[model samples]
Target: MEYREVELPACKSIALIAHDNRKASLVAWCARHREALAQHRLCATGTSGALVAEDTGLVIERLVSGPLGGDQQVGALIAEGKVDLLIFFWDPFEPMPHDPDVKALLRIAAVWNIPVACNESSADFIVASPLFAGRSQRMVPDYERYTASRSAR
Candidate 1:
């Protein structure tokens, strides 16, 4: 399916991430919205990306493995204003060794004023919003500033 650019702020770039356990749910969810999601750019971490691509037949920009810095890479994309939406189906119940990176990714989205969906419910909320059909410009902080702050600390 060819997903054209929609009006939503996140329609420009959408990041798809899911933990090992939640990969299936994420895949299932994406399959349900394949048509809508196809309208935007899709990115994902190594394993997750591979799995999703295999399951849904969507070409995804694959990054490194999450525990191996994939999450940080995607987070950098968000900080750099390259990503507009983040859909991360994380398993909060399990402790991840790379939790810090994941948290940082989510925080970067927040710091940059981008919309992020951490769970299935929020993903639905974001995808269903009329704004998803209308492109809206949002003021975001400078990527340099965020990087500088982290460096300073």
Candidate 2:
């Protein structure tokens, strides 16, 4: 496996997400953490972004709704190294129509070695960590080498 070091800047690009049932909690959390979160760039699916933005007054780049490929859009951002962290307030109990897309987004985050907060507690830990406002090194996929190896076969 190939790997490379990627640095997450002091000001990060964070993604916010929440299932419909948990949207309220996510919005509340955004409000509570507004001071800390305000220093970073934020993005989220359409409805979630709007709610969080309304509550926290923080600007967020809105993508399509998750069921309408928003998760994939976020995954694309992660893949392209545009997003540094993912704050997903997912409801574990729900069976979503776009379950595969959600999984794909989480999987891509893991592949990219970005910090992903699946719940409020996890989000708290990530935000409270020193790396939130400083550089943190993570190993990312060396896709170029992988592609070259595949092409040689």
Candidate 3:
């Protein structure tokens, strides 16, 4: 696929998601980074968002629960260039009924060339990165070019 460069603004739109078993971990992580997170926009699956907001007092845009299509919602936002980062705290030991949705969300984040942190350690590194503080550039699929090429086939 053809790709083009895009700039992520200084204030990014971050998406948060967590499986049932990992919700507390995600909330604690948010509380730990509350100050840095406050500077950016946060959105999360329904339950996770509410927990984080209640624990850290950070404003969050809540979407439907993950099992109920919240992962797809965040994926759509990523595809639309509205979400810059994805922080998902999913449990690997436990099988999830909504595993497909989780996979799709991660796939979309990769396709969009956005950063994703799947655990607390990665989340810490992501938030502490120098690029996290300012504008950063990333290459993403050039959908229009891809469409035109397909049309020429």
Candidate 4:
């Protein structure tokens, strides 16, 4: 795929998502990073979002529950260039009914070059990077070329 560079704002728009089995871990992770995270815009899938809000008193733009289409909602935001970071704590041990959606969400994040963290250690590393608190640039797929080629097929 062809690529183009885009700038990420110093103050980012971060999306948080988690499966049922991973909610507590995500919420705890959010709480641990509450202060730093408070500086950015936050959005999340339903139940997890609510729990994070209640636990940390940080406001979150809550989408629908994951199985109820929240994954698609977040994916759309990623594709639209709205969300800069994705911290999805999904359960790999158990299969979810919406597994396909989960996979799609991850794929879209990658396609858009959004930073993502799937666990506590990864989250720690991501948030600790100097770039996390500063404006930076990333490479993303050149969607115009991709769309044109697809239409020609």
Instruction: Indicate which candidate wins on TM-score.
Output: 3
- Candidates in order, TM-scores: namely 0.84, 0.97, 0.98, 0.94
- Please give, for residues 81-152, the per-residue lDDT of candidate 1 as tens digits: 688889999998999999899889888888777788888899999889876656776766554566777899
> lDDT of all predictions, in order shown?
0.84, 0.93, 0.96, 0.94
Candidate 4 has a TM-score of: 0.94
2 against 3, candidate with superior lDDT: 3
Pairs that collide in candidate 2 are none
Which lDDT tens digits does candidate 3 get at residues 1-153?
999999999999999999998999999999999999999999999999999999999999999999999999999999999999999999999998999998999999999999999999999999999999799999999999999999999
Judge candidate 1 at residue 134 and give its lDDT: 66
Of the candidates shown, which would achieve the greatest lDDT relative to the real structure?
Answer: 3
- At residue 28, candidate 3 shows an lDDT of 93
Q: How many pairs collide in each candidate, listed in order?
A: 5, 0, 0, 0
Give the TM-score (vs. native) of candidate 1. Answer: 0.84
Q: What is the C-alpha RMSD of each candidate to the true structure, in Å?
A: 6.9, 0.9, 0.7, 1.6
Tens-digit lDDT string for candidate 4 (34-64): 9999999999999999999999999899999
